[model samples]
Target chain A: MDLSDVRRHHLSVVLEHLVCSGPRSRAAIAQETGLTKATVSTLITDLLDRGLVQELDTPTAGRVGRPATDVGAAGHSVGALGLEIDVDEVAACVVDLTGTVRTVHRHTAGNRDVTARTVIHRLRDATQRAMADAAHMGIDCIGATLALPGLVDPNEPTLFVAPNLHWFDADLRSLATQLRLPEHFPITMDNEANLGALAELRHGAGQQFDSFVFVSAAGGLGAGIVLDGRLLRGAHGFAGELGHVVVDPSGKPCACGARGCLETLLHSDVNPDELARHLADALRTVVHLIDPEAVVLGGSLAAFGDEFALAVADHLHADTLGARWHPCAVRRSTLGADAALVGAATAALDRIISDPTIVPTRALAH
Target chain B: MDLSDVRRHHLSVVLEHLVCSGPRSRAAIAQETGLTKATVSTLITDLLDRGLVQELDTPTAGRVGRPATDVGAAGHSVGALGLEIDVDEVAACVVDLTGTVRTVHRHTAGNRDVTARTVIHRLRDATQRAMADAAHMGIDCIGATLALPGLVDPNEPTLFVAPNLHWFDADLRSLATQLRLPEHFPITMDNEANLGALAELRHGAGQQFDSFVFVSAAGGLGAGIVLDGRLLRGAHGFAGELGHVVVDPSGKPCACGARGCLETLLHSDVNPDELARHLADALRTVVHLIDPEAVVLGGSLAAFGDEFALAVADHLHADTLGARWHPCAVRRSTLGADAALVGAATAALDRIISDPTIVPTRALAH
Candidate 1:
């Protein structure tokens, strides 16, 4: 690549850093990014001209040097849309460059009609409303991300299988195409747990740790894992299926036709009210094995409050080897129902900045 | 950074490509590395003068230009040693830049006290013998890697636990210090399962896939997972504790004081013959969950033969979501007892090349 290409990419990178790592001075950015002061200055100038970044009035003073002007992402300059399709509901949200969800919408779907076309229609209507609201707010929607609960074949956009939704061999891309989205816009999709993990990594409790696991206890239990600072998507994009892992050989029968899966014991179907008790019993078995830094609880079950997180933590502490003094902290989701939406927005924003050619699009009307 | 620093690092990258991805002519290397032909030629000449690479006699004909000679790593220039300490045995091997194991030594420890000091002493003696034998056959060892079963804190050289061998918090670097090893020689220590996964990634069934899980079903059950082309060492280096994942809520009690871990189901406690059936049953559960690209049967359980693998495969097929089709392939480990040892060698080789300042130490004296 030419020097100009490198410089342009660096500019985008600086913008991303500003958005992800919060505000910082030019010198601080240079130290964090390992880019020279001259290069950062040049990139910062370019970003400022584009209205992507702005200098704050507050100056940062340190022991060794003069006060430096702090800079941060210009939240209004760029926006993204996040769409989440659960078994019973569809959620949409518009997020700004700094991962702030500015608007949210939720629509309950009819029971048991989760076919590919039905989901496509629901998504189309939801996106249209979300985009309209975003426009009303005077913000441009730059990209959209879709999150689903199932295995997504990364190589093939259309191939997905969500057991709870009874969706199999569905062509998501074809459905999106049928919606007639905007020409320049692109729709990105990923597994819900993966996106949840990404959200935690970028914006939640997982930010401090290089590796962590995020468990979503909803209709079914799933885990999003981060290792070496990256999402651990397996060979077929089927990793983090912690629910399917057998916690009992002859326990309850799971929807996946397996007996004694972790999901069978911890899923909402077992007993929504008693989920904390069930999760505590189940987690007592896993804590000693991995000894993770922390285990985060999200999804609808996390809404049960600190009681659920505490119950699991207590059991883990009691069951771990040597009564390991350090119990993996269990925290509830901070974003509530809007987490997946926020994650989807983050994913969309990441996709756009990583590859500027990607354009934002709206699902086509039937 | 200066332009020359970037250029030099870029050249080193080209040299690494030539070493790892086999040989290429100067012109081809230039195109692939995006460096100019003159730059490539100069680097290749410097490398050749240092005996790091050799030019092939055969010239290849191309449609667009004259034939050119291919240059490749000088296999005999540098070598690495890998040592694996198991509960019942110890294995050592020497490997070249091309990942070819040239010499191997296996010794029966027969349930001896395997403290860090004792293990280091044994390794030093074995290394001496192996080096002498290799000298007679014409081979050299430039670096060493040690693979041990435990929760290895990467930031520290002590092991948290090696349940099978009954070692806890064993100081590895102290043992190295006591041994008085050679200066400027690299030595590395890592978890056995992680090393086994690394070995498979570089030289075994996983070479073709970017992500896969290597389950070590031996005296204990553990896993080494690779995601997005990197090993998944969780926060605090305890990521792949697959054996500890609860597989049974009310089942047998695990040695880790947990109830029904995969290790409890899979490992052979007293005699291999006594636990053969249990091993097969546990392997079935493992195959049903992750559905990895390939299930490699290694450790002591692999010695049981294809019947064990086929039996597990049959159970997996019968219990999987879609019993109509097999989800993943099953295979026996080709490296057998030496898998972890070879992996250690690979890790040592990587460390030596990445940081030339590493010093190799002699084995600890009893």
Candidate 2:
């Protein structure tokens, strides 16, 4: 739907929420949203007319006299494309509103110029393949969203910095245009950590949390901070640059030229697999600063599993803060490689239903 | 107005915004808030009926058709009270909605027990005097809010820890009750730094920026963080304890029993006036980590003026981040000792105007 079709988009959002959260009566939806019951009933009726929602016969107890019908989103009204851009590989998937992956595609990075043009070319081919696979399964794809590891400007379709990809100043908007996608089809992009956090917030460990920081540890360390039920993109869209924050002054010199950045010490290259003991010792200082609910360890390194996460958590516990032993649980990302892709799909769905204007059509050309 | 009177509160809020922002046409308010023009018109009419807002008679050109009526809040409806509790003193003030302080009261402290009880006693006496003065000037007092330098449970009316006061687990709600406050009146308490940041967000340097950290340096250090237009209270209301975050592993011992906490290193005792040069060197590390919009210097130390703040800022600039130098501006708090007090008053006023249920009445006193 386009920006002009806000009413339809609003209905789609209610339908999507109902689908994600299971069936609920119009009264329940109105209660949760503070929307008028009449307005909700009208919206649900519109959704039913569009074949986006189905009313079930079941009635919830608590209503005195009248039986309320529960309505849920249709599972196959539309589909979303999720793209994940890594340093050496790209992964794409088609996911339904309920977060079920319908199709998947993976590609490797060649010795291409890691510029906007080159990445867009790879994305276009991958998207085509995924769409074809989905089509074979009778699934209709709607739009796409890309998730990458680096700084991203939400206002502009572009990468601020993707150090591992050796890309900088890449215009994602123009790249998507070159791919020749549908005119009004929307595309969205955000940092991998942010996407990971979004995924967790919607479908995993962070779902119940109002504030938490998701740390992605791979080629570089990045954080996705969710505060008060919203992602915190700082004043300059650089809020979650937790990796660049100085952790130790006398330690290793980072590429960012700062001494002992969280990434410089925590990354696999700096500590190595054999130096896990030393890594635990180094991490003690960081945990004391930001006392997050849970320090979620994601990315390729998290594949090592619970042992590594526990060792780091153990060392952090030994460090005393004001005679009170400060402890934060450390856990690995469950989605692993697909986390960012899932996050991207969620972002795309959110855009389609909440703010159609946010997604740049040019970014989805491929 | 009670919580049941939501429409009245909402209209009052619009009128309050108009009053704070000066005269604005209904069309302008509707555009600024994304509220429907019809809704704005209806609300404006209701506000005019209540005598909370008045329509301007002067007509201005520039509109396509008929000029809209300008509306603004009646400036003399209510006054707010702010109370600040420090280690050695208790300060109180009565301020108008426009942030004009009509009167202030200051009291000294001798010991923890005596101080806590005496502060509340003095606060009520001072508030009564201030109300008398306002009554003579024809302004009505609404409610009071207290700002304390410690961990506070907003859900519970108590001070968790007032280190300088040497009070722990003090029942502040009981004190408020003993003072015999008006029924259903709002009396709120919050962390000093959070309120300081709130004050800045609503009326100071932070108004233009959505996210930044406000560090209050006094006998100890505390931070007020604003992220995405909301305060980040963390999972537990103790999010902005930047002072207690361990910075040095083997540095001088802090009162909190940690070595080299930001507070221990930056506080007045650790950095005596004679050792300003040495303290400036230690302060550089903090400035690098959180490259905020501006490092606001508040508390008693701010009275020393630009020289002290500049010395700390000078050291921060010397420490480069990569090839780029950190350039967060340093400014002293304009509110002085009254900052936390003003912040508390604002918080109280916010609670009174938003949710009457949250405001503990003597009837519901523990």
Candidate 3:
């Protein structure tokens, strides 16, 4: 392999280590990565030159050697613009490389009843506000990520089905054209629940554990599955469609054409107790399928808090079930409505830091 | 890093390519891996010396250079031992490195009625017979992997529970002592469904897709979650316990003590029609959550064939179910009862071939 490619790989490994572990000395990175001290030093210097790392001036004593200076990630300068098109509103935010949602711009609108043109324009308005805010704050935009509540095809930039939004086969690339986005910026579209899980794992109720199920209940039910620190998006990128699960064989027919689908039950004009019962039954399905550490309830269920948890635990114990004892905790979503926006920003920043070549083309700061 | 460690990593890369993508020339491998031609040559020579690869007389017609000789994997020389402990039987088999089951030996017993000691004896007897068969057939024994229909923590060598087998926290390491296995021949204990999914992904219905859910139903429903190719066991190793999901709030209480659970519905003394309806309802939960390409039915349901497919399809379509046309095909288990055993063999062989240092310590062939 060429020296440059090798160097890039080493730099990636060192940068990933620093990002995941907070900060470390060059000698510590070398020891952890099994790389030589000289190689790690060269990589650290390169990262500094690229505006990806900064000297922390924190001295750390080595077990067998002299102390070394520590370096940390430089996350303040570069930022990611994350936008979301929800049924209730269009939201936008700028998140720095440090995984902080620095600014938020939200506009309330009944997006489902509006035309696709109206929705796109509203999203454009939010993006403009977010972009201007980032510009004023001197945070350079790395890239943009749009989150939607739908089954997005991983192979294409298309939202295949957002039943709640009543938008089918929505082409995001053309929509970006409608928004008049810059040519250098690339857009990535994904399911909203997936982004919520990323945000929760990074900075929400799921921060304590490496794996959990992020259940977003708004106009419909969706689950973002994270296991072993990775999101489990199926082959078709339609993995976590938890709302469509059958709650009753004889219940109401859902838009999915299934009798007794969980979403139809959740949306029924029922009392709070009845609503919690329906939601819990749906959650029981998730717990049985994937016994995660916690089920982080977001969207509509976030406000219920203890009412929701007690109801779900009343029927099926979140922690333990059966003779085998499969235990899981139930908690409210930490980020709530902002999870998707924050997660999109995290993803964009992640892409830029991991693959620096894209940074120059996408990030205005670089 | 030392030259040898670097070579091992490159060797792993080259061998992984060969194993996954079939045979390729040194020049082709160098090009594909971004390794130098000289480095590829050195790694190839090392693998050949280790009996992991062999050169063939088949020559490739190059577009510009002289024809190069072809090489392929040496699989027959090394074999893995797979064993299984289920409610109905204790089984064992030997599989070659190329993913072929050379021998199968199984003993039928009412495992659920028997004590843990009795089941362990039956498993030992089965392993002995299978090991003898492998020896007689000139197949080398690569360490054994034991599959149990229960929850197994990765950090512990124990079976947490096998409800059908009436087992709770069965100690595998102590049981290995009773089986009299050699010290270096490490025994790995995992959930039967996880192993079944691995077998299916490699040789069964799941070979076509990188992601799908393998549902193992016998005494209970268990899910083997394969996402982006890796099996997802949650942080606590208690994932994929699908039978525990509540189906009918008014239904009978399960061993997990939840009323109207999926397992309770499945186990009701019902006709094939009723059984299929229950199974379909349960399958619907999996499809809604994971959205796999296909749901490969295994365990007791494998024998039902179209009866199971028709019944499940009666209420819920296997694929294309709703306003969201999620078309996932339905297929029966290819290996049936042989899945867990075969998958265990695959795991054992995979471990040995991928990490050569473990080969000599465990596998008799090395």
Candidate 4:
């Protein structure tokens, strides 16, 4: 690699260490990253100049030599904007670089049976309101990510299809153009299920489990799978699609045009016992194929509480092949229904942390 | 990284390039790896001395400068031993470093309901005969991998359970001790389905597809999933347990203690049409979850031919959610029944390719 590329890489490595591992001394960063103390100090200085990191007042107390200064991700100076378009709502959230949510603007609108242009306008308004709130709180929006409830085109900002929203091949470029988002703003799109899984990985069950599936059952049945700490998007960015898995071949037709999908079997009319059974059948497919460490019930599913979680766990325990040995835990999502929004925000912040060079060198205006 | 670690890493990189990408001149290797020509030459010289790579007589002809000599993986100088223990047979195969099978010994025995010790004894005899054949062919075994029809403890040479073989927690370390395998011979254990998938990835349908599932239906139903060229082993080694996925949650009890499993529904008594539907249910689960490029059906199931494959594909097309946009192909296995054996041997060969330093420096005996 060239000198500039190498410098950018080192800068990202140092910044990521502080973001992921929390506050630590330069000596510890050098020891962990295997870079020389001089290189780390230089990178930290660059990050500080960019207002991405700040040195803390607390110093090493038990050191034999000079006490090293602890550095951490700067709060409120830099932030990310997360936008979401679900079947029944359009929401926006702004989170600081430290992953603290500063503002959330959720508008409960019947987004279904509507055109993509209408939904995008509503989302744009919500985003503007959320950005205003973030600016009021001293947070600077650096990048943005939009999470939609459907198959998202991984290469571009396009929502290929959302059965629940009755939206197909929606052109999301207008959202960026209408908002006048910067040319290099790092605006991206992702499936809400994938974003939810990412949020769980970053701030919830992911802290304890490296591999798990986050099932979102808000207005639709979907799943976000994490394997070894990475989201599994599959060959066509359509993975973790639990809603489409066929539960019965001769059963009812699904919204995706498939017959007898797991989504078809799951309905509000079904009693708790039957609901747990249907969920177990879908979770059974995940447990069989991925054998993840746990399955986090997120979105509206967590609202069912412990009784429902235990019922689903019982079914999983009884049906899974290696339940006698490797038991897949069924847990409730700590982030509840906001996982996808949080995940979207986290993904946006990751852009800056991944390449701190994007952040201009400037001090925080006091 | 330390100096030794860096050197070892570069050596492995050069060797892996030759093994995976075929023979290339020193200049090409240097250009591809971004290492200096001098460093590539130095690493190549070490590899040549170790008999892991051989210098080819054909040189680069169209280059502007001097014609650089081509280097390739050695053919018979080093080899690996692959052993397998199934419910009905014990087999062993030997393959040279270039992934060429040199010898194979198969013994058909009803290993079901038999003790793990008895099966291990038979496997040992088959391995010894194969090793003798390999020795006759001027191949020296550097490592070995044993593939079992059960869950393998990823951290050790232990078979946690093989329901078909009725073996639970079988101690495979004893087999290594009985063979008097070297302390660092790199002996390991893996699930046969996983081995089959790896083999397919290296030599079969994996050539055309980056992500696919290898379904093994010889005596029991199992699946080996490859996503983006990497095997998905889940949180535990028990991933790809497709047989136990409940098809009829209350249908019939399976050997795995799960009622209404897909395996329970799949029997000789079931007709081809019914069989295709059952198979499609499982494949649908896979496609919905992974959305792979294709699904390669292997083991005894491949014997059913194109008619069965087409029927299964029909069901998948009718049942899959996004079949129009992202259609998943259904294909028969090209390697047939030998995929697991080849995968086992290839994995053993991977040990040397992954760390060329493991092969001691020595010229070819000839």
- What are the C-alpha RMSDs, in order, of all predicted structures? 5.9, 6.5, 4.1, 3.2
Q: Rank the candidates by TM-score, best first.
A: 4, 3, 1, 2
TM-score of chain A of 4: 0.91
Candidate 4 recovers a fraction of native contacts equal to 0.71
Please tell me the TM-score of chain A for candidate 1.
0.85
Model 4, span A1-366: residue lDDT tens: 334666887888888778777889899999999998988888888899998999999845986888878999899599999989898899999988777888899999999989888888888888889888888888889888898888886777677788888888887775777665656666888889999998888788776898999998877788998998788988888888898776665678777776677788776377878878878877887898898999999877788898999999998888577787888999999998789998999888888977898889876565
lDDT of 1 by residue, A1-366 (tens): 545556656776787688778999999999998899888997777676655667898644555668888899767666888888888888888888777888887889852455677777877777888888888877777777788877776556754567788777777766446555577576778778878887887888778776667787555677776765567665666666667766566777877666777677664355543556556544443344344677778887677778767877776676565245345677877656566678888888886466432332223243
Which 10-residue span in candidate 1 chain A carries the lowest summed lDDT? A355-364
lDDT of 1 by residue, B244-316 (tens): 7665567688777767666776643535443543443344444433335666767765787887667656655
Over B219-305, each residue of candidate 2 has an lDDT whose tens digit, in order, gives 567777776546666555655676765555556777665566656666535543433433333333333333355556667557777
Summed over model 4, clashes come to: 0
Tens-digit lDDT track of model 3 for B1-366:
445556566777887667656777888898898898998898777777666777877755656768777666666566778988887888888887667778888888888867888888888887888888887877778688888887887667877877788787777767557776766676777888888888888778888777777878866788787877667776656667877766676789777766787778777787877777676777777777877777788888888877676566655574234324556677788888788888888777777556654433222345
> lDDT of each structure?
0.68, 0.64, 0.76, 0.84
Q: Which candidate is the best by lDDT?
A: 4
**Ten residues in sequence with the least summed lDDT for candidate 4 chain B:** B177-186
**lDDT (Cα, 0-100) at B110 in candidate 1:** 51
How much is the lDDT of residue A127 in candidate 4? 88
List DockQ, one per candidate, in order: 0.39, 0.25, 0.49, 0.61
Summing lDDT over every window of 10 consecutive residues in candidate 4 chain A, give the lowest-scoring window: A177-186
Candidate 2 at A218: error in angstroms? 2.3
lDDT of 2 at B4: 41
Higher-ranked by lDDT: 1 or 3: 3
- Tell me which of candidates 3 and 4 scores higher on TM-score: 4
- Candidate 4 — which pairs collide? none
Instruction: Report the CAPRI category for model 2.
Output: acceptable
